[model samples]
Target: MSEQSRGVTVTPQDDRYPGLVEGYNHRFTGRPEAVRLAATTQDVVDAVQDALDTGRRIAVRSGGHCFEDFTASPDIQVLIDLSPLAAVSYDERMAAFAVGGGTRLDHLYQELHDGWGVTVPAGTCFEVGVGGHICGGGYGHLSRRDGLVVDHLYAVEVVTVDDTGRARPVIATREPDDPHHDLWWAHTGGGGGNFGVVTRFWLRSAGPRPTAPEHALPRAPRRIRRADVVWSWDTLDEQSFTALLRAYTDWHEKNSAPDSPGRHIWSNLIVLHRSAGSFILNSVVDDDVPGAAELMAEQLAVLTGPGGAAPAHVEEQVVSWMDTWMPSYSWPSDPRGRYKNKAGYLRAGFTDHQLAAVHRHLTDPGYDNPMACLVLTGFGGQVNAVAPDATAVPQRDSILKASYSAGAWTAPEEDELHIAWVRRFYQDVYAETGGVPEPGDVNDGSYISYPDVDLADPVRNTSGTGWPVLYYKDNYPRLQRVKKRYDPRNVFRHALSVALPS
Candidate 1:
């Protein structure tokens, strides 16, 4: 390791290189020429400037939770590791919380709630880094009730290169009088690596500005009620499976209104491949709300209504928000298996054909991966209350978010098998539109957070709607302008980065 401008730089043969290059998904291997562990904003500035002057391809790694290899690409020569810049502090000048881009969701949640009794609606995965998650318009359990995490974003401090190729740090806020307002708007949902390196994110409530930190963001829930209802795959016949999906989709379509009671509840239906033994519906509701138990019961009834068979087991619990706020939040297993994932947004329920395709692929005995599954989580409600162009995130009218994923052996030899399995599964399900989920009645494009590079591949994405339209819709043009302005040199870019203006 060598000290460089207040940060540490290491080569592939260095002792820290192995740990620094390892990301959440073990499938990809990154062997950048140098890795810079930035301890502060200045360190990042210096590292970036050095890379720029030296003509090296730059990449950044925050939480390393990206499903794709944006940060782990082979073209990368310099990797800026922002994990050391993790800090959560109150900004008296802004009257809001200033969270370092490197801060993980778990630490940010704990500090914000414990220090000020406030929280930003964000992703469920605790290990996710704020750098990418917020920029991609992150949503989770509290989203339906409070809106998106970016909705609370007030400002961002980022490092950028000027027209003369001079690296500098700039802050952009939502204030009307702020000259960098466009820069701030771009970060709302423009996705990371397209503009610049975000060092800090200022979070506050969407409404009236508060003079104090305690009153800045929405108050954290007092307690949360959670339940896990499981159904054995062996006993779940096609009739029951079809019924279960219908009940789930029907309920979402009926209760997606901004004022619907379902807004207080959020759930994910994990339809794992048959090898998993059972499918589970894990849900959570605000325990402090009136009739909370009844709401959960209502959802359970719908879930089991189709099967008519009793759940193999039901586990229910109520705990303070702080106790189980970050459920299932854990570090990734070392030497994990190779993985591939795809995502789609739905404005309504799944079509009968789509449902049948799901059953057919999941029940197929040809390919095997117990960890493979299609997880559908209820969306909309408060999310749809915002206008389509309120921020860079335009998928405001969606009712559900579907994720198609598979995890298989880490051995290089098995990579093709798992990748093929997930690709074929997703393609067959969306055969009506194309290999990809085109924006339409059944699918409303894809989520940038769960990005799939295949969407940009012509052979893979037969969906007539190009990749940019699927993710940004009409917002793509605006994002391009921001890209041209902030990243003129395209110093920070990857496979799916926002494109520059033609």
Candidate 2:
């Protein structure tokens, strides 16, 4: 390839090229001219500069867990891999935890919990990189009590391209008086690959600055109570299924308050297609909470009581937080790599009519994919305590987050069949809104973390709302301004990236 930088550069002829070209989703791959393995901030700066100097389109990859082809598109000529920059430590100078942008969630949890009894409320997918997750306003089990990852963000070190096309590292913090304060706000939930390559992020709880590392972030839970409740397809009819979903959502609507007792409880209802044999509801709560067991039991009773169909199986346990937070912790695996994901935020529970659509699609006899499923995860609580304009993530009143996904296929020919199933399933659920979730009283719009390009496609998204409005709401204009100031050349961009201010 061209002259190499300080970091290692692999070209198409390199033996490692094949592996680097692909990402978590096997659906997309790139044949870039070169893949630069950046191990430090300077390395990323040099790599980005090289790409700009050569007039080659570039993209950055960390844990390779992106659901879309943003980084692996064929148009990318230079792929900058940041996995080597993974590092986690307390920054004495900033009085915050300094996490490498490339660090995985699992690694970050381990380092934070082991070194200091603290952790950020990040996503549960251990393999996800912090680079995109934090910027996209990630949330997880602790989110109900702790808020989103971005809510605790103190500062970020991003390598940005100036108007002169020179790449340099800049540090932006939450301090309003700071010159680059807006840059920090944009990264809060602006999504990744929009402004520039993030080299590092410093996290600290919002409030008075803590003098010690251990007190810098939210304290990690000592133990957690978990329950797995499953119901077989044979046990569920259309009425029962609808009741079950309604009951789950209704509970969240009532309990998703900043000071609600149920804020400590986090649950996910995984509704699989009939071909999967059964669906599951996984719930967790901090065992240290008073009456934790009783709270979980009561929640379970509400769900089963409505349907009158007892769960086919129920398992409960109490385990150390490390047992669940460690990188070794594993969940059910999908052998098939290719997948499609779409998500939306719900301000209230699904109506009866919407529930019927969900039941009809999951039980459709024409589609037999076992991996196809709908997941509704608990959201809000502390996440809603923040003002809508305080961060780029403006959906502050959502109670539940719903994700529609389809996977488990090895052949490319099955792409159309699997993709169409999920698209139709999502469309029918929001049929009242022109085939996509539009901002309204019930649906607040979609999540940027689970980026769905289909929202940008006119053929798929019959809704008049554009993708920018769906993901950012009124915050899009602010993000566009940040894009103009930091990346005037638009050096960092992808399919769903913020467009320049017109």
Which candidate leads in TM-score?
2
Runs in model 2 lying further than 4 Å from the true structure = 1-6, 324-336
Q: Give candidate 1 regions above 4 Å deviation.
A: 1-6, 306-309, 329-334
Span of 10 residues, lowest total lDDT, candidate 1: 325-334
- How far does residue 431 in candidate 2 sit from its true spot (Å)? 0.7
Count of steric clashes across candidates, in order? 0, 0
- Where is model 2 poorest over a 10-residue stretch in terms of lDDT? 325-334
Per-model TM-score on C-alpha atoms: 0.96, 0.97
Candidate with top lDDT is 2
Query: Mind giving the per-residue lDDT tens digits that candidate 1 earns over 1-502?
Result: 2334337888988877888898878877788999988878898899999999899999988888778889999999999988877889999889889998889988998898888888888877777899999999988888888888888999999999877888899999988899988899888888888888998999987888797888888888988898888989878888788888888888888877889998989888888999989988888888988999999988888777643445788888887777664655333444565779999999888888898999999998998888899999888989889887878988998889999988756677888888898998899888888888788887889988888999998888887779999899999998898888888888878899998888
Error of 2 at 413 (Å): 1.1
Candidate 2 backbone collisions, by pair: none
Error of 1 at 128 (Å): 1.2
